[model samples]
Target: MTSKTLSAFLLNQLNELKDRGLYNTIDPLEGPNGPVIRMKGREFVNLSSNNYLGLATDKRLVDAAVEATIRFGVGSGAVRTINGTLALHVELEEKLAAFKGTEAAVAFQSGFNCNMAAISAVMGEGDAILSDELNHASIIDGCRLTKAKVIRYRHSDMDDLRTKAKEARESGAFGKIMAITDGVFSMDGDVAKLPDIAEIAESYDLITYVDDAHGSGVLGGGAGTVKHFGLSDRIDFQIGTLSKAVGAVGGYVAGTREVVDWLKARSRPFLFSTALPPGTVAACIEAIGILQESKQLQDRLWENAAYLRRGLQALGFSTGHTATPITPCMIGDEEKTQRFSARLYEEGVYAKAIVFPTVPKGTGRVRNMPTAEHTTKMLDRALAAYGKAGWELGLIR
Candidate 1:
């Protein structure tokens, strides 16, 4: 096709996205992604961030990042195999292992990369992965890349998992088997049935993988979902992201020393991509230290979530089955969800509307992530705006 024709086609697709209310425009935050963030010269009660423990703007983490950048220069300069493995990387991995109660740990460029690296390294073609239907996109993509037979169980449905697991094993058609689930479903804010999953994995002799990206800083007093279920020593692979709770950019796989060794040697991202910057590594260490020091932040975060949840329910809005600090205010239609999000923005709250392909089509919601730093007063203000928007849109009486 001619360049002009290709350009026209691309533009048409973009227009279609706009018409569908799925074309998201970037709203640049002028300041740190704190409880209240400055955007376009106005401050909004920032509820869209994954900075669960509010470590993104913590002074200790900031200081550590700055110090590391000054001491180690900027980048790692090459991939881990070449000259990229810095002392900070090793230190961070060790720290993560201790935090997760694992024998060893391997760091990757992103949490998505951790899933991509770990899954393909262990389970591949002729293997099977029994995955939760509501797992993160990263987990889904990782499973797809492995060329493994992806058997998806209904979200947290142990019975369905058992049926699939028994079938995969009885057939003797797979070399290796894994059962994967998110510790917390991001869109719905529901905790996964890790206890049930672990039991099922043991019964099927499946390698247990839990991507605790949302759980790392919010659950088990910030140790993660494995610890939340008291299965820290039972789960095989516990995947976590430093970007979300740690307020840094990277991911890690915490498991047996053997798994860590395999990833270091064979994982494509660790082998091919440059290591995480010194600043981020240092910041992650600082963030973990904060979590280790006290449960103050975690407690405050839950308090804020409960307060916000109660306020939303009082306003006659449905919070669909939330079990964590991640709260979703359910709105039925895509356009209505978009309009609700826009109205929230206009009223100075920064939560975004999650639509189709993220969640299911009709279950679109305005996902609110209330952090440790948000005050009850701020939540009250947000609740007022929500009530106003709900009434205006005829969503609540």
Candidate 2:
């Protein structure tokens, strides 16, 4: 039965969130999450999906998933360490390693799980982790899971990282030190300074980990941020997600063969959780192949992003230092940000507002993710809506 005390606490917290305009309402997508999406019987230009290459609805991925499902059934039936490691899983890992230019790779059910598994698997009680101040929530949680001292340095501040690394190393309080960061920060769309990080890691003998979830299939000719900056050989752990630009689902860690072997043997998720389904694995494999085959999709994706970013800037919207396609139209106030998003929705755009906890308070924004599938007409329409919404809310002149 439900406890009254617990229920009351939940109600109070929810009420507070709503009162502050911090409660997010989920919009059920009525169809495939593509360049345009349907919700509540209405279609809108989709500026909210992470489908950078538009491969989520591509025929090749769909066909691959269907064929694999028919051949292997719906599930893997057991954890990977048990009897669930299918041939498809092996093939996918090999493809991922080659794509990331690493000696080996290991797959997880999701990008979140990859961090949860990999961090705890390698680092333990006596170790310390030097993390970026603005790293993703998954990385933060993963660090928490391990019994390590987590030192947060300034975001992308190489000097701060160097200082912290030196202090951690000199203190002799930890057995090992790992410097982890997001290759491409999803919120602000800025790329991490991997070259500087690699240099620091080498000087301090720190293990380097880059969670390139938002970088794969978008940068480095689709190889990712590590490779984009020519540091693939320098970074120790190269993590990426298949759900974003790859247009499938799952996460992977590409590193030396020894590290991959260690993770396969020790990562908790691989040891305890059921393996990713064969269909999803097969789809991911196909997506990687698609990305490897050409740079056409990546080119189109960048072109669209550039067009949208230019339009927003021209419209007087402040797009924070975005080096990639994840464009955020900054709106400062939480309620005003939510209202701006609602206004956009009313005008046939589906850009979502990112509020507190996702970003720091007072930094709320409407993040626009323009994909390769978005045409000029669609983007122009979205810009028009942004202008109208901004004017209505007195956000711009």
Candidate 3:
């Protein structure tokens, strides 16, 4: 029923991806994506999941989800603007705002959607945005959707951001200017120089927006990067994801009451997309409560990361400038990176190869996400796999 030329075109593109070693074949995980994942009747040390605090499989969180489901049924059944805003949703947003140290917060179905909704809602044509070159795909897409003039500054280079902010302000071509950056860059696991960034924003009067997708539950004692540097009151928009450390499904933009009020009134994704199910919203609230009550989970997570980082570094594998727990084992060649990840999987580690387009070409890596749930024995096994794989591939001496 499909046109042959169109089908051929799709097939050819896929073939090109395969030829260039860019095709990603997703492995089917047989069980929960936890510290150890089961696949095809075998277990592998899971170093790929974003469950940094191990809340994804925590029984308290699971129980909360189940109880909420039983009480509220499966779905919210309508967009947020139309009969979908539940009391639990409001509680989740309130807790999110409190956790992020903002006056108010608004939730979206996914973190990607949060960027799309928040960025475009606040910025539009005739506005100008200064964005970090390495900020995330969602950020790039959000800026593009705004129809705003987006100027890329060198990653974490305060000098470049300063220069761009001055130019953008002095040019007098824009109605408004904003500077956006990730609180934590996931690929290299580097924390943004937020204090410096805040100083620049204040001088130039540039609105600050930080997508703290990788920072929440991992940094600032689980508050986030802005709080980590004591700049919680400086940034205009503080964005985070519940799906990662929160171990639930949703994203939020926490800012002033005006910003949240405006988003609720005008943000397209929030207005059009159906609200997150009751279980996710309730579980997310419970996660925040968990984080607020204790930093024990966060402490355990860091201990695990430090242990693994030391082990990997001792094994002569370069884990790049990671201020957080997300570790990247740099493998320069794309093909070799792919092969390295595959060999590690075969040997019981399940880290995924992150190659070109995801990161710059030739800076491919097998990113490791160490969780609180991982035991020392599991990390040891993963290190042994890395050692054997690196030796076989002539990557490490």
Candidate 4:
């Protein structure tokens, strides 16, 4: 097809998305992502970032980044196999392995890439993977790329997983079986039942994978979800991100030393992509150190989450089945949810609406991420705005 025809076809889809209120507009932030952020020249309470610890702008991490940059210069200069793996990367991997209580760890450029690389590296062609239906987009893509038999279990439904596991095993049509789940469901903020899943995996002799992207630095006093449930030793692949609470950019998979060794030799992304910059690696090490040295931040984060949840409930807003700092205020209609989010932004809160494709068609919501850095006063202001938006939109009586 000609470029013009392709553009016309793409624009038609774009217009359809806009008409349905599902087209997202990027809002550029003028300042750092904090409790209060300036975006598009408007100051608003920022509740949309994954920076749960608010360490993205922390002075200590900044200093660490600066120091590493000065010491190592800009980039690693080549792919990992070709002089790209620096001392900083090695140190960060060691720190992460210790932090997550794993035997060893392997770092990748991003959490999504970690999923893409690790899942496909271990479970290819003839293998079968029983994945959670609501697992992240990255996990879905990883499974597809592997060309594995992807059997989806209902979200956190142990019964469904057991049924699928039984069926897959009885068929005897796979080389290996693996079960994967998000340590915490990002949208609903519900935690995965890791202990139960681990037990099932043990019974089926299936490899276990837990993508704790939303659980690290928030659970187990900062050790992550697997350790929170004392399953670090039980789970095979524990994938996590340095970008969220860790306040840096990259991802890592912690597992048996053999797994790390295998990934080093076989993972396509790790072998081809340039390693993380020295400064970014150093910044992550510092972030992990901070998380380990203190539970004060974690405590404060939970306190803020609890306070926000109570406030939203008091206002009669249905804050779905969330157990973490991720709070989603349910508004069924897509347009109404988008309007609710727009009103929130206008009222000085910067939460974005999530609609179809991200969530089920009729279950749109405005997700709120209350951070440790948000003071009680800031949260109170955000609550007031939510109340106003709720009442104005008739979301609550």
Candidate 5:
């Protein structure tokens, strides 16, 4: 039986969210999350996926997953610390370490869990974590899980970070100090100033952590943002997600052997959660191999991003300072942003609106993710839709 008080509270909160245009409505995709997707029996140009290299639907990945599934069955059957550490998992970790230019790596079920596990496992009471103001939700939650003092600096403000780091270090109030940030800020599509961050970390003797979930397979010829700035050896922890550019479902932390070993021994998620499926591990392995073999896919991804970004700007839409493929068409009002997305849907495009909580209030936008699979024709169609929608909604001329 449902408690009336609980039910009333839920109803009130939901009603308030809906009234404020902050409630998100989810639509199920009827087909694969490719360059074009179908929802509710209608196909639309898919500009809303994290499949940066279009490897999600790649034949090689599909084949690899199928073969592994047939050979190893559907599930791993136990947690990683117990009996679930399959050979495929080990191989995937090896490949990940190699790709990230690290000595060792550990995998987790998802990027969120990886952050939750890694951050909490290492940071605790008497320690402090200096985090970016705009770090991902997972990072924020992970920091919360630990008993550490979390200090948030301005988003990508190196000077603010330096000030906080110096204050934290000089006060001697904390035992260990760590500086953490996202390699790419997804909402605004801006890359983090990793070199500057690294310098500050060195000056303050702070441990460096970079969550490169949106940067892997898109920078440094596909090595990631750490490598993009030639700071792979300097950054202490390199976190990435296989679900995005890798086109699989998992996350990993690549670092020195000691750090990886410590995580494997102490991380709660690694000890309690069931391991990733063999098929998924195999697929991830294959994707890394593909990325290592060539830069063609990365090239295509950049080309498509540039094409879409240029088109949107030509249509008089503001795309925030994006240094990578994640392009956001800035629309300030929450209701108007939602309406613009709906208008795009009506015009056969599937760009989703990002609102408050995901981004700050009054900074709502329709985030467009142009992938390697997006052809010129598809981009043209999307641009046309943006033009019409913008003019009709008084967002553009």
Candidate 6:
């Protein structure tokens, strides 16, 4: 299946990655990705998934998915532009718009692809984008795809953003300038300084783009980060992921009706890729409906986060500058951090080690994701495991 030269190149690259400890060896779960998971016939408290609200395994979501599958079949057979757009897809978009308090919305197959679609559709070579330095990889790639001049500013630094915004506006080198940031930094768990970013964007006439993948179900009563800071009317392109808290597989952008229409007409993902399956679309709609109807799940998520964070900190682990539920316990060495994560697995927890280029070097960590489904006892058990791992590794005394 491969030529000799290409095969050699692949083998060499694989060796290089392994030599540098950059190769990732994946561990597949045996069954459902829930509050806990089983691997190699051993159970561990799961703290690595992005299922923040526990809706992924919720009964209502399961029923909705099954019912949609029975009614619509197992697949959506073509691209949205080529007769794949189901009534469920349209209804999901409407629900998404309502949930985000936007005039309209457009869905994509994945959150990563959604960014690629949205950014490239609106920006081009003559334009410029001001991006937060610590923004998600999807955001970075999306900006690059537009062939725009990307200007990086310090993470969550309003002053730096203001300066960069002013420079970009005054450069006269670009036809349009956009300021983009992640609403919640996934690694650090810190919220974006959105209010300040909004004000700066307004002053410089920069288009505002926020990828609120982590904030959709965790903040603003499950609306999003923009709404949390009362900037719903101010943000231009509001992007979110159905896969995260919606317990489904898709992504969306909520904006003005004109923007949504334009994206539908021009966005590559919507134009070329096959539409999300009917069942996923229907389940996504149901999940958003559940969120809009109640804040019970959101409250439980926060309670769990607080309990876990407090427990970890009290046990002498540093949770880096987090404002939300994403808890990253710092371990300075890359190899040691990997070992620490292994120790946690041995101690019966599934928190994963994050290293460069996920985060910068010397800032490697064992990131724990506490979900709403995690009971107090489950959290306590995870904490105990963390304590054991940290102590045995001399990470804590």
Model 5, which residues run further than 4 Å from truth? none
**Pairs that collide, model 2:** none
Query: Candidate 5 residues 1-397, lDDT tens each?
Result: 9999999999999999999888988999998999999999999999999999988899999999999999998999999988999999999999999999999999999998989999999999999999999999999999999999999999999899999999999998999899999999989899999999999999999999999999989999888999999999999999999999999999999999999999999999999999999999999999999999999999999999999999999889999899889999999999999999999999999999999979999999999999999999999999999999999999998
Candidate 3 Cα lDDT to native: 0.93
Tens digits of per-residue lDDT for model 6, 1-397:
6899999999999998777766788999999899999999999999999999988988888899899999998999999999999999999999999989999999999999989999999999999999999999999999989889999998888999999888888989999899999999999999999999989999999999999999989999999999999999999999999999888889999999999999999999999999999888888988999999999999999999999999999999999899999999998788888899888888899988898889999899988889999999999999999888889889898
Off by over 4 Å in 1: none
Segments in model 2 whose C-alpha atoms lie over 4 Å from true places: none
Best by lDDT: 2
Against the unseen true structure, what C-alpha lDDT does each candidate score? 0.92, 0.95, 0.93, 0.93, 0.95, 0.93
Candidate 3: tens digits of C-alpha lDDT, residues 1-397 = 9999999999999999999888999889898889999998999999999999988888898999999999998999899988998998999999988888889999999999989999999898999999999999999999989989999999999999999999999999998899999999999999999999999989989999999999999898898999899987899999999999999888999999999999999899999999999999988999999999999989999999999999989999899899789999998999999999999989988999999899999999999999989999999999999999999999999
Candidate 1 least-lDDT 10 residues: 24-33
Model 6 global lDDT (CA atoms, 0 to 1): 0.93
Count of backbone collisions in candidate 1: 0
- Residue pairs clashing, model 3: none
Off by over 4 Å in 4: none
Clash pairs for candidate 1: none
Q: Mind giving the per-residue lDDT tens digits that candidate 4 earns over 97-178?
A: 9998988999999999999999989998889999999999999999988878999999999999999998898899998999
Candidate 5 has what TM-score?
A: 0.99
